[model samples]
Target: MHFCTKFLIVITAFCSYSMELKQPIVSYILNKINNSEEGTNSRADPLSKNVEGLEKLLSETEALNQTEKIYTVEHLVKSNGYPIETHYVTTGDGYILRVHRIPSSPKMNASNGKVAFLQHGILCSAADWVITGSEKGLGFLLADAGYDVWMGNARGNTWSRNHTTLNPDKDAKFWKFSFHEIGLYDIPAMIDYALEKTGASSVYYVGHSQGTTAYYVMLSELPAYNSKIKMAANLAPIAFLNHMSPLFQIMSLFEPMGNFLANLIGINEFMPTSNFFKYLIGNKICAEDSVTEYLCTNALFAFCGFDYAQLNKTLLLFIIKYTPAGGSTRQFFHYGQAIHSDKTNILSDLD
Candidate 1:
């Protein structure tokens, strides 16, 4: 057989085998759980009962009509009966970021006036923490536990695409930053604001992916900020890129051409969120029960790894509405450089 034909055959076989393995296991486990829960107290088996209840709660949002839904982190928080406040922080470098806060729950104020700030990963926004909604969203859960929940949107994403003078659309300089700037400027500014507002000397910081990268940059560049944070929880923290996945390692080979590729495509600001894409992906494709829903799930698995049993099918649509919120090509290229060079915590080419 021809080389191309042989490759196609192998790819087809792999996909077929993967699907065969995925579907049956998921179906069997779900069916088994449902069968075990039916018409039984099963209180003795709290784990099974909790799993079933959790699944039911996750699916509850699936019934919301498309018209009734407002696709935003603030809307999700408010509609679920939690009070949300929108605050803007201007970074030292002039990028204006929109931050979200769940100040208090119905029962009490922030735990002894404590403050917690949540930061999202690359190509994401503050919406990530609360997108799953009240039942399971970490933002809401933290609020209910009496912690002041604050979500920060880094510059270049959906929420922080503005600057004091530079227009993101017109000024290439506005798109000049990577996650390095976010750590060096944005994180400290937001944290200072949180401390000033809450009168807390320090904050509990939580970050995911590039959020964690920003934290590393802040500590590396400005060690004084360490005294300002009570504790930091890094989720899927990314700094060293010496051991990347095979797929990303291959992509890093083009690091030498990063600037050329970025310029050739005329892509300074990458994947900015807009209403058109929100509707296309959220309403048209990943809408509840849509046939194309699997495309979104498969796409996520392609990059993030596959854990079909842990995938929340119902909130997939809402997540599609908010993600890839926007980023800069340079930010991505920086990661590529790190992976290719086997560097740890190298913020930019100049560094």
Candidate 2:
């Protein structure tokens, strides 16, 4: 009798599971049959309508919500319900840069009224400041804190690849600039634009990596712009690279032959926004569920420190898609020169 009871219990559980699995299929079949019987004239099934409504709602919500992430800096800002403005500045040498601005925020009502210029590092764009989401992104945080934030993209990057005269795609002259031009031309144009628009005498300048390098260049080459800066903050400053990481140290060894390598690759604009990265790296290797995700993390660990606690595993996918956001071969070659010479000089006197 106990054996029979156990068998019954197993059979009952199986039947219940089968019903659960078959319900959706059964409903679909029934709906089709009912629709056919209705001679294609009846109003749509309410259930079907509800399901369609739900799907539409989800797509719309996802469009507005950037929790999943996006590639455009301005869209990323708007999706987070922040005010964003796109300003184009023509540099002294004719490089047209796309600058992003968060004019004000609900958090502080523009009470501070001071302009804060945030510049991105090598191979990056204005998007870098706002990619980490609103809560953590420097751009958003600054806006929330009452400062008018302006994020600048250096020339040869994804956004700033435009020029008044030359074409970025076909013209080698378009890609001829290094960070020196960025500091001399790009910074002054962006800073002057921001000040003109906001009517602020001087901006609170903040830079990261090559951004800091550009700031130093600006101050050194054009001392007149010094009066236009309220203060300066440099993050991970790239002033003196005498103690650069082993990875850069190895890469710098090829600085002498940088021109040869650049020619070999036919790389005028290096690593622009492309499908190669989006489909290959973003959707495949660096994807959260991908088996080869470690390659992404490990690569960062190799360049940056291997601090597990600091790594945001999910954010890696977004970073991979947006970054290597295009730069010139000369820009990187300059850094390689700096690493070799153990100096902050933009133009190497070693030649």
Candidate 3:
């Protein structure tokens, strides 16, 4: 399929799906996020004043929704009434990554159809594509639209935390990869696996944030893979660090120092958890009607341009629940290097 055509199909599906929702609720949420611009100010600490009350309210609300929590990608897909298949792809570096597939949906006859590979961003997992629920998420939407949808989980994430030889928990070598290894091994492994399973010559590639970064690297360094991809759709692509989020700007300044600290502390893995993540960011910042809701939401939009109208406050918890699914410290350090050097290529220590 043509790139523009595929994009339009996805957009049209999203619009049609959106129109089917209870507009009153959607409209109210949109209006609140849009009109309350003053609440999203970055200068103020959103959680500083009412910390105790916020924590209490969030705890109570979480207790109420305890039965509804979806943790793994398999649980997420099956809960949404979709048939999902789990495939394991072993990277060249021996890391075993999990890929999720939604072969068909009720809305379309997807047998023998074009395959669409969805890759998540940094510190994310396959669950990121489906966290927004069945009606809104791209994974479900693509499946319903008749595309054979496959979501990739990069190595070192929640889903891809295993290796053929080394144990992730004890082996320091397992965490020795940047996105460079992800591009060279993970992407190709998933691509080959998906194409072989579906008997397809080429597949459409859709990447977001760091997903796009790896795609660019793969196409640039190993051009042979170009023949295997039909079209590449990059969302919020991050090739240049000239313009960065304030949070990242501050982190960039401490890249070298942070790397030193990581080595000193012997911390290899970054924030990868279910319970802690839910309690921290999900409950504390995004629980329903929390005082600091705007702060957390705004930080996200500030880093990746705010689209108030599209901001659904209700889904914030789901977003938090699935994101920061964990990655190597080196992956983040690699981006930090890019930020300091202002170059896209991987930097050596001597550089």
Better of 2 and 3 by lDDT: 3
Q: Best candidate per lDDT, number?
A: 3
Query: Across residues 115-193, which tens digit of lDDT does each residue of candidate 3 receive?
Result: 9999999888888788888998899998988889999999999889999999998998898887778888899999999
Each candidate's root-mean-square deviation in Å?
10.7, 15.7, 10.9
lDDT of each: 0.73, 0.73, 0.75
**Model 2: colliding residue pairs:** none
Across 1-351, the per-residue lDDT of candidate 2 in tens digits comes to 123223323433333343344434323334453563465625332222344653554455445445434568888899888989999999878888899999988677545988899999887888888889889999989889889999999998888889999998888878877888888899999999999999999999999988988898899889999999999999988878875544466668998797567767767776686654554456544667443344455455444434658888888877876787889878777777887766656544223
Q: Rank the candidates by TM-score, best first.
A: 1, 3, 2
What TM-score, to 2 decimals, does candidate 3 have? 0.77
lDDT at 253, model 2: 91
Error of 2 at 3 (Å): 61
How does candidate 3 score on lDDT? 0.75
**Per-residue accuracy of model 1 over 1-351 as CA lDDT, tens digit each:** 123223323433343345455454334333444554573434222223555653453344344535434777778888888889999999888999999999988756437577999999888989888888777888888888889988999998887889999999988889888888899999999999988888889988999988999998998889999998899999877877765433345557886687677767677998787653465455544555543345455545544545679888887766767887999888877787787776764665422
For model 2, the stretches where C-alpha displacement exceeds 4 angstroms are 1-70, 303-305, 344-351
